[model samples]
Target: LLGVGVAQLADYTQEDLFAQALREEAAEQEQALEETEAEEEPEAVVVRRWLPGQDVRHAEFGPGWVQGSGVGRVTVRFETPWSEPGRVRTFAVDDPALEPARPLPLRRGEGMDGEGE
Candidate 1:
């Protein structure tokens, strides 16, 4: 079935493309309106500091390092070398449930070269 008019799609398509180009043009525009009530925004989105294999301890989940981080959150896998792999958990960047800890030792002969083999 025929929907909108032919010119409508073309006009709106042009308008939509113009809007997209406008947004891309304003990609770095952060100045507040001098006559408006707008407020200044943060310079950057966020800075995730957690790294994989880094030592970390959770209040209830014990200890684990960061598996990955994004969207103002971090994922962690908790487990000790002697035990099975730990469960994965995600928490806020400032969640009191987690804290940094010392790194763990590698498995037998893992750090050394092929000498162990």
Candidate 2:
């Protein structure tokens, strides 16, 4: 009877050790996966200060004018012929696609009125 009890005890110890080993392996794997995902994540986009009346361009939306700006967002009016006139779109200030548009140079005969002599 005592021998049988010892055998059962030994079996339980082995099972406990195996379970602990599996738990440790699973924890290690989870940590490695988290590290890999962190490496794969894209860098944060740098937000630029945008003010009202500023001209900006977007990669997909084309040219737009800044109508207003708030804490973390900027409101823009894009010239989309297919959409309603004066339609405004709001985007995150840190959007990587939005950039300041270069001003066009005016010719000698052309003024702010765009009238050529």
Candidate 2, 8-27: lDDT as tens digits:
58988999999999999999
Clashing pairs for predicted structure model 2, backbone only: none
Model 2 TM-score on a 0 to 1 scale: 0.44
Runs of candidate 2 exceeding 4 Å displacement: 1-46, 80-84, 104-117
Per-residue alpha-carbon lDDT of model 1 for 1-117, expressed as tens digits?
577568657888999999998887676353334323334544555544777667788889886778988788889998866568889999988787688876654574455343221
What lDDT score goes with residue 11 in model 1? Answer: 82
Name the top lDDT candidate: 2
N/CA/C clash count, model 1: 1
lDDT of prediction 1: 0.72
